[model samples]
Target chain A: MKLYNYFRSSASYRVRIALALKGLDYDYLPVHLVKGEQSAAAYASVSTSHLVPTLLDGDAAISQSMAIIEYLDETHPQPALLPADALGRARVRAIAQDIACEIHPLNNLRVLRYLTHDLKLSEDDKNRWYRHWVESGLEAVERQLAAQPGRFCHGDAPTLADCCLVPQIFNAQRFDCRTSHVPNVMRVFEACMALDAFSQTQPSACPDAA
Target chain B: MKLYNYFRSSASYRVRIALALKGLDYDYLPVHLVKGEQSAAAYASVSTSHLVPTLLDGDAAISQSMAIIEYLDETHPQPALLPADALGRARVRAIAQDIACEIHPLNNLRVLRYLTHDLKLSEDDKNRWYRHWVESGLEAVERQLAAQPGRFCHGDAPTLADCCLVPQIFNAQRFDCRTSHVPNVMRVFEACMALDAFSQTQPSACPDAA
Candidate 1:
């Protein structure tokens, strides 16, 4: 198996943690998002969407972090990334999407560039734009953590939500979003970060780390 | 089962189509998103993240349209929303997330409101922002459809990918995006819409449709 990834990509970071957690071995192939490698012809063949973290398993290829991670979890049943029940899975996905769907999409590099260049917003305004969405999205997630958080984002063992949460928290911290307000997110993130899976997959440690 | 839905919510609409495809009988309880009813205390009880399309199955309340729809498919196994093989499932999920994770999040009502009220982007600029991202995202999706698409976004039948595609296409149209560049998306969307499940569950036909 090989993972087409880029350090600093929260999406790629997500699949890395899942691969590490599953105790699976795979080649880490870097595709730099900043260099426009993702949109180039080489990467497009590997990923039709031209996105990072496209996992190649034998003859099969997969993209999208959540889907790839879920693919790993489903294929490797033990050390499951999801809880045993349906509702539990729902809670996990809801929290993940609170960040993936609601937050990260707006703050990603492409959108930021669009704001700065196309919309003619300054850096200060762009960062402010980044922080506002992060703050609001995290607030909703923090409410969920306050209500249902355990050792990780869902229950005691690290689940699919943690795979998503750790990356978003990494991003939240990188953006300097106010984590002091969300103690539960901070706490769960600390727990997740303590794990070898999360620790080994940090952006700075990746082969593609800039 | 009961669904907390808003007529125009793409997320809610995704779940509605999934329920219909599964032949599942679900009571729809409209939560008016435009009216801020989604954030009201009563709706908050069922939704931890204060989002719409919270599926209440008996006593189990599930959030996240993808998760809820997946749960529905899991429990009712016939006419599966995902393919049987891991690779097949991954392809289905990536296609779904290409829209759900990357595109729709950026163009959702809340984000549009943020672009307008918070960023002070003129309505024209906001719509431009909407169309730009929507068109670019679908262009990538068109590349995806070229390789794996059949009668629907995946193989001949409507899968989870189609559920995501149809709503996103609806949203792009709502913004008056350039559909000529996304013929594959338009094709899949029209194919999905032709189905009774998709047609009946459409935003215009919903109980809360304006």
Candidate 2:
């Protein structure tokens, strides 16, 4: 298996954590987002959107970190990323999407670039935009996490929600977003980081880390 | 079952199509987004993020349109929203997320409001922002669709991809985004709209349609 990723990408970090949790080994291939390597012909062939963290398993190339994680869970089926029950699965997915869909999408490198370059916003304004979405989005996650009190995001086991949460928190801290209010979210982030699976696969641990 | 939805919300439309596809009856409780009704305390009690398309089934209140659709597919299970096979499911989900994550979130009302009010982009610039993301994202969707030429998004039958595609195209049309480049996506949109599930649940057909 081969994973095309960038060190700082939250979505790429997600797939890395899932891979580590499942104890699966893969070739770590970096697609540098900052250097515009993702748009180069080489990377674009693998990912239509020119995004990082496209996983190649034999003939199949899966884009979208959530989809790749789901594919991993289905094929491997151990240390399941999703819960067994239907509603449990929905809650976990909702939490994951809460981050993946709501928070991360708004603050991704491309969107941030658009804020500064295309929209011509000042650096301070750009940072303000980033912190606003990340802070508010995490507050929602904190509320949801409060509802389902657990060692991890859903249960004692780290599911997809935790995989997503850790990266977003990493991003939140990077942007200096205020997260002191969301204690439940911070607790889960801490718990997930204690495990080697999450810690060893984080941005700073990646081969491409600056 | 009860669905807290907004008439013109693409996410809400996705859930409405899923409910129609599954032939499940749901009470359509309108949450007027443009009017700022989604942020009201009453809606916030049901959804922390205050986003529309919150599905209330028994005691479970699921937010996020994709999660709600997946829940419906799981509990009901008659017309499966996801494909049976793992790879197929991944493909379907990737397609759905391509639109739900990439295109819609950036073009949603709140994001547009932020662009205009906070960033102070001109109205024309705001429309350009909307059209830019929608067109480019649809081009990516078109590439994925072209790779796997199905009558619908995945195969002959309507799956989660189609559920996401129709609503997104509806949004694109609303914003006057260019669709000529993506013939496959437009074809799929038309095919899905021909079905009652997509047609009847569209914004204009909704009881709360303005």
Candidate 3:
């Protein structure tokens, strides 16, 4: 398997964490997002959306980080990323989407670029936009976590929710988003960061990191 | 099952289509998003994120439309929303996330509100921002559909991908985004709209639709 991804992309970070948790081995093929490498024809052939974290398994190429993670879990089910029960799976998926859909998309690199270049926003305004989404989105995650308190996002074991939460928190801290409001979310982040699966596969530790 | 959802919300419409496809009945408890109902304390207690389309089944209150649809598929598997195999499921899910994560999140109500209200962009600028993401996002979907060339998103059957696609295209048309660029996507949209599940549960057909 070859994973084509950027080191700093939260979506890419998600797939990396999932791969590590499953104890899987794959070649890390970096597609640098900042350098416009993802838009090149060669990389575009692998990813339809030209987004980071396209997992290539033999002849098959899977895009979308959440789908890739679910594919990995389905193929390698020993340490399941989702719970065994249907309702449990729903709970975990909702938590994952809380970060993936609600937070990450608004603060995407392209969206930020549009804000500054197209809309003519200042640097301060751009960073403010970034922090606003991250701060509010994490608050919702905090509420969810408080409702269902656990060592991880779901249970004692780290599931898909943890895989998503850790990366978002990493990006949030990078932008200096207000983390003090989400104590439960921060607690889960601390627990997730303690694991080798998360710590070793983070952005700075990736092969392509500056 | 009781679904607390807004009529025109793309995410809510996805779950409605999924339920209709499965031939399952759900109580339509409308949470009007435009009226600030989603932000109210009563709605917030049911949905931690205060997002639309929270499905209440017995005691479990599942948030996130994708999660709700998957939960419904799991509990009642008459007409499965996902594919039978892992790779097939991955492909279907990737198509679904193509809209759910990439396109829909960028054009969300709150995001658009921030663009005009917070950033103070003109109405035309805000509308342009809406069209930009939708047009570009649909082009990516077109490329994926062209590669697959299914009667639906996956095969002859209407999978989770189609459930997402139809609502997105509906919104695209409402906003007058460019649909002519993606013939393949429009073709699938036409095919999906022919089905009762897609047509009957559409935004206009909903009880709360204005």
Which candidate's DockQ is highest?
3
| Real contacts recovered, all predictions | 0.77, 0.72, 0.80
lDDT of 3 by residue, A99-160 (tens): 99999999989999999999899999999999999999999999999998999999899999
Residue A16 Cα positional deviation in candidate 2, in Å, after optimal superposition:
0.5
Cα shift from native, residue B195, model 1 (Å):
1.0
Worst 10 residues of 3 chain A by lDDT: A44-53
lDDT of 2 by residue, B60-140 (tens): 799988888888998999888898998899989999999989988898999889888988889999998899899989998
Q: What TM-score goes with each of the models?
A: 0.97, 0.98, 0.99
Residue B150 CA error for candidate 2 (Å)?
0.9
CAPRI quality of model 2: high
lDDT of 1 by residue, A5-63 (tens): 99899999988998998899999999989999998988888898888889999977788
The model with the greatest TM-score is: 3
User: lDDT per residue, candidate 1, B68-93, as tens digits?
Assistant: 88888878888899999887788888
> Would you list the clashing residue pairs of candidate 2?
none
Worst 10 residues of 3 chain B by lDDT: B112-121
Encode model 2's per-residue lDDT on A24-131: one tens digit a residue.
Answer: 999999988899999999998888878888999998889999999999999999989999999999999999999999988899988889878987889999999999
Off by over 4 Å in 2: none
When 2 and 3 are scored with DockQ, the better candidate is 3
Q: How many residue-pair clashes does candidate 3 contain? A: 0
DockQ of 1: 0.77
Candidate 1 off by > 4 Å: none
Per-residue lDDT tens digits for candidate 3, residues B142-204, read 989999898999999999999999999988999999999999999999999999999999988
Worst 10 residues of 1 chain A by lDDT: A85-94
